[model samples]
Target chain A: MKQSAKLNTVNKWWQYETTASQKWFQFGLKDLYYNRGLILRFTRRDLLASYQQTVIGPFWIFLQPLLTALVYLIVFGRFAKMPTDGIPPILFYLAGSTIWSFFFDSLNGTMYTFISNTHIFNKVYFPRLVVPMSIILTQAVRLGIQLVLFALIYVFYYFIFHTASPSKILLLLPLLVLLTAGFAFGLGLLISIITAKYRDLDNILQFFLRLFMFATPVVYPASIIPDKYQALFWLNPLTPIIETFRAAFVENGKIPYYPLAIAGIEIFFLISLGLLLFKKRELDVMDSI
Target chain B: MRELVLKAENISKYYRLGLIGSSSLKQDLQNLFVKSRDGLTVEDPQHIWALKDVDFELHAGEVIGIVGRNGSGKSTLLKILSRIARPTTGSVRWKGKISSLLEIGTGFHAELTGRENIFLNGQILGLSNAEVKTRFDEIVAFSGIERFLDTPVKRYSSGMYVRLAFSVAAHLRSDILIIDEVLAVGDIEFQLKCIAKMKEISRLDGKAILFVSHDMQTIRNLCTTGIYLEKGRIKLIGDPPKAIAGYLNLDTQLSKHTYSSPHEAPGNSYIKIKRAELENSTIIHFEFWYTAEGNENLSIGIMLYNDLGQCVFDLASAPTRMENGLIKGACTLPENFLNEGQYVLSIAFIGDQSKLLFDFADCLNFNVQDNGKNLRWYGKRVGIVRPEFPIQLLNIDRDGAI
Candidate 1:
């Protein structure tokens, strides 16, 4: 039975049309806003579930970066004799690993959004973006805990050796963290869309991300890069954010304001493109996943 | 006039066959570059339309039940309506929010406590913290698991888990709810509670519900309207009774014998139906192979039903001892007693005419032919059973002088 066309009001109705052209870029921003409570609930669940069965529980958040920094200290600082730009090697590695871990954790958490949550996605209707957003939030909370470890180590190294100073660029600390998170969110969203269809991409993505850390100057200072490769190295979006983050606290690394600004623009573009593609693929991904 | 809640037009879904997620990259590239016979980019030969040209409308307070055989697009239609998957073509327009319980406890975390899961499940179903808080006591009370609220759901029994999940879902405040057989879970008492809750919501709250279920009894009890789907299309849509009849008729097969051998027949170890078939004209013949371990006073009962799921007759043979072998039983229907229509027969094994040992429903179906001639009437006679009784014509005299 067809109703009168005049009764078809548009404001309150959710219209699902088949054409890909109309509203292709909606991004479900309003729905995401309305369902923010759902995001919080999911984030809480992830936070609780991650440590529920572990013996030491949430301490793993602080231990992960500490152990990674220690491994880098022995492998790169002592064995390979990589320079830390006149800063204490442990503090240098801690700062780099702490910030880089945030990016890594965020990407790892959000990249499998579609596949891991397909069960729920198949049954319920909410803003699909909430899953990835909640994942990002969970990682951010873990990053906060890791930051406490970073702060404690920085204080110990600063008072004893006077090797680090808070530079004026430290004001940009929040901005730097935001840029790193944005890049991860963008990359994670793109990876999830592709992985939903091609599941084998996950193995390749993990390997590629492992290799990508070498390109971002996470274990070594940016100054160690040879002058000939400097131009090419800056092209990596993460190079600027990582360098800026270390420079803000340690003051030994260069700020690279122009490059940082360029990285910001790049991250903004990447996130927009990620959101558009994610929204487009969200509905169809359910079937393939 | 009731406010229209949902309207779907020409919705269809096409799924590619064979290894969707694991398809080779080479094939994907070829699919992108190659042109089909119609010059379109797509050219997959092995594909099927899971749903095709399905159109329907739901108004406020109307409960519609969807029934279909497996792979008949019932799930695809629900997925499209709930926005879980996009349709291949056409569109759906709906006012108000839709909350679907394609399953109970969809996003429950096993490691999380029941109390936390309640909030998580509630929010996933589109409720806010304030709303969940308002109904928190009601949900807990309905589930009857407040003692285990702080315990992780992994420790809850399967029934408790399902009860908690359904309780949260039942409390969701939405204009439209799409449920897919969630009531089939839990014990019968909880199921009845859920059915009553659904009825109350539709009646008192005026929420529109689109339910998909294979349970005819629940469909008849809960739905105001029904849609029977067949092979990806809407075969019938009307009142619940009519649609259910259509669905049941579509499912009925005219098998002379439901099982070819006694070993494969449907029954327990005590009794099995060896053969059940319609004999010459009106004689219904069946063979039951029963073991000697069964009770001696075992009686066989058969109930006949018409297309509308209404029973026409129920009768049982006298109690008799069954040997450890096949026993022949026959019940002859009096000619011209049954109306000319399709009828389903169900056999029940009873002990001492009191306890039901086993019941097999709609095991065989037969059509009573309308070959009987009635000279007085030219058209068909209507009733559940058409019986001919002796009639004598008498004329009343003018002054009682007959």
Candidate 2:
């Protein structure tokens, strides 16, 4: 059983060095590329395992947004009389809630990356980013399904009811999805890394995301905000993203390019900061966990 | 010359002892303020080094065994090598891809079928989709759970889970493999098969391996070189037998005869030998505390072994009935049953058709000094046991001798 005889002649070597000044913020794109297959596999597992053994299974993905939109239609549209910028209440709320849910689910899912995967992370070494990335991709798939449902509902409202018109700004829909993902991912990663060390932050995060949902234009039109406080509302990065999404679907809704651009810049900064913190903390977070 | 595949230098890791996460934001703020005001770091007092200044080099085909008692930094060293955790200071370099089997079947979802988990686990271990697909048959065959491949892993028995897990880990293709005590799972046959597979991979593919195990026999059987860690430092490094001997010798020196607390004693909740010792080096003295409701067919087995890890004598008590409570038992080995050498005593509590309630190995150690009785015969005894036997001589007629 001696292994000496099987020795090969290859001399290639890879060296790893640990120092106080070690670059922890390299983004590890190469490592991520190397483990891309694992990311896809994890995404599949998350999608499959989420609804496994349940009767409704994948139907729940569509049903969740649909039901939430219905609740908003009855409560905000009828009871509260919230203005939707003259668009049909169902289409307005459906568009806003479906997009909002995608962002919220992505953020929530990424926030649990460290806590939920601590067991696997503690045992194995792959690109740690793959877990969060998989969460984002899985949420993205759910978003895609919900968007198709939104499209079908939009067609029925436009052609059948003749109450809504598709805007040329709808071309920005893909950009809106990308921005939503970036915003959610950046903020989620930041929170996830903080919670790994401070765990108390996790409790605060749920409360914060829930409260922040009201600030976004998911339930009411952005036009309803008083001009004096519109600046304050736009300070929330999600405002511009949600406003732009709604604007692209309705005739009277206006695309706020300046605020959207500001939000986009903020997202880039947030994600960079998030990645920096995540990279620095990931090395030693397992010891703490 | 064999190619150098891996090298680690001055590796050290420090871990905090108390609560891991911050308690609250208010406390964290206060601590930060206090830390800045005093101009002193507060982290030093709360941290202890799990590993310190460990250095090693491995060639392409070397299978090095890391041996130490628990908490001696053997696992910490492996964690550093495997890239699961970065060392606080120091570096490790290796050739080609490295795969770590820190825990077998890591990330195996219970709801996923055995077939799906095979692909998932394989990818997690750095195997590509095509790679897993090609090796799927071999992995399934090795696990011997082909019939249940379509069944969810949750439905698989613990043994089947371990078999499937180990099979996937064993099939991982990499230039270097780092494993920690995972072979302790599964059946003895599977364990041996894993050891053989490790040897074959190292020989045929020239993969370097760093294996950590508390099982000294496996270390002696499979490793080409050994590293003995003690209190976060490398105590000995070289031959496997020598390192294992050093580790065992260190174990005996640290705790001479008695294991004081239940924590120090090795056993499960069912039974534990609270304290064990030797009296006058001849009559073995030991006491065990057992807690079992309706203790029917309960018996104790004691074995004596020499310093070289060879069993010289083994004896078991007859079945005895007892009530539920803290019960103590003492047994004495017959006189002159062992020769003059360092001996380790192991105990096992067996109940109901020899089912093991608890087993503790190397529980107590004692020395025999061989008083002047065999002075003319030896410098040291040749064998493990010196039993007392009767001898007789008879006269025979010369005519009948032919």
Candidate 3:
């Protein structure tokens, strides 16, 4: 019943040839593309599992950002009297916190890709990229819910005080989000490989993430920093992104083209380096992890 | 006419004993700076080969059962073939998609409901969301947990959890399926169902299957070909019966029964045991072939032992003169002589019916199975031998006129 033609045509064989060292550029993008369903499934699982036992399950997603922004509003706006570039303290802090949390949560989730998913990774073979991608998606979903809260407060502020003004640069919202996600995802990829080898890096990484919040001007505006440190501060890559986010949403401000360009290039380099390390390390990382 | 779906050539894997998964940045730093003699890294002595020079090809619609003892590299070989781990040497070339069920419920989340897990697990095994949706009803029915489909899987008993997991795996459409002792879990009825499903998939889809299990009955029944692995090397590759025989012979309690070359047989110069095997059917036939050169008063003796090392019986053939020629001695164990348990056969060549020339201890291992028709008291039949002796009455003593 079998045909000889089937045997003669041997183009589809997948050769698992174990070489001494694999090529660093072979990112297995084809495999990742094939496993898009798996990525979506993982994201759904993470979102559902995040708030399963909690009361008012999805409310926690918005509550987290609101509470953090409230704390920053009191500490920096009322106590320290930090300048807010003439934007409302609550709106300014909320916008910064919203964008910062998207980057923070995505990076936090993606950095632990190897440790958190050790059980599943040991048993099955999917693109290792799927984990970070899903982490980004899960955080993006939470950000979406938090943005709804931000919108409600912005509308209230606009109707009462006429302070919030939408800018043409607001059209770049999707691109800004992409840049934020890319920054977090790229840095998280590199950290994941590091943590996979040296588990001790986990504690050190947590401390650095907290320190990085202040470095990025999440609770305060960029105008407050002295002019001498301005050039040095813009090198943080996240500086221009946060500043551009605030410029587009709550203030009628000009976009910092030079810093934004610098941030974009930095993000591109980080992503390329992160992917190279990931592709190189993912094959044998299971043995160490 | 079967198509070759998987081929592994000279595959080998090595593991460093104490240092597995302990690689840290500190060690990497040390290795970076520290230099050994001659600028070559030192080979750690703890490195051990889990698999060495393993090679085989799997054809479509063929079920290959891999049998080995614990730590015998069976799982390691499966890991390499499944791409969970890479081989230290050699490579695997395969056509078509390969899906491995290394463990049931590999990615199942405890908090997720059964319905959610079905979709999650299906996609993890390479099914699209639409594909999973199409087979959702069939998967649930196959699992027989439709009543509890919405409950969190963590609340389900372990049995229910595995059933749901296996159901998802069973619906997977792959050209090659790799299974590793998943059927060893679950109850008997479910195990049988799993086996039947595997058979149906392999038959209808012409999928190449690689299975590993400790259960010999399942191997003999489900597998078309068996691979006997001993210490990471293929001991035998043939029909299931032959491979199973070779694997059974590897047991410490019962060792090899045949030494095809007389030079390597269990003997010095006088006599050698070339072959000693039992052929079981309605009658249990044992045959031993040997060669004796110096002794003319060679006699063949055999001792049978149960699994507990208890001697069941000892018998000797009449003394016979022999020269430098091949010799054969045979005996028949009547039906029902052996109980339902493992037995070992030890053959000895004797001189003048007194002096022992060569004694091959525990030469053959075999099992006598129950016919499964016992009306009651199905537990193990008492004793080493359960012989059915003939019984008759000369007369009924009707009116005492015998």
Scored by DockQ, the top model is: 2
Show the colliding residue pairs in model 3: none
lDDT by residue for model 3 (B1-402), tens: 798888888888777676656677777777556544323235556667788888899999999999876567998888877767777778777877788888888889999999999999998877889999999999999999999999999999999999999999999888989999898888989999999999998888889899998777888889999998988888899998788767666345433367777677666666666666566533223333445545558777777766544578888888878665666666777776678887767678788887777777656777778754543657678777887776776866668863
Best by lDDT: 1
Q: List model 1 lDDT by residue over B1-402, tens digit each.
A: 798888888888888876777865787777666644333335456778888889999999999999876678999899888888888777777777788889999899999999999999999899999999999999999999999999999999999999999999999868999999888889989999999999999999999999998778899999999999988999999998778877667356654665567778878876788777877547777877777455568898988877554578889989886667777888888887877777777789887788677787667777777766755665557787888777898877768863
Residue lDDT tens for model 2, B115-179: 99999999999899899999999999999999999999999999999999999999997888999
Quick one: ranking by DockQ, best first?
2, 1, 3
Q: Report per-prediction Cα RMSD to one decimal.
A: 14.3, 11.4, 11.6
What are the per-model DockQ values? 0.37, 0.41, 0.32
TM-score of 2: 0.79
- Global CA lDDT of candidate 1, please? 0.82
Give the per-residue lDDT of model 1 (tens digit) for A113-210: 88888788888888788988988888888888888888888889789878787778777777877888899999889888889888887899999999
Per-candidate fnat, comma-separated: 0.73, 0.71, 0.50
| Residue pairs clashing, model 1 | none
Q: Candidate 3: TM of chain A?
A: 0.93
**What TM-score does candidate 1 get on C-alpha atoms?**
0.78
Model 3 bad stretches (over 4 Å) = A1-21, A249-251, B29-43, B250-340, B343-402
Clashes by residue pair, model 2: none
Q: What would the per-residue lDDT of candidate 3 be over residues A160-222, giving only the tens digit for each residue? A: 888768789877778788999999999999999889878888898899999999999898888
TM-score of chain B of 3: 0.65
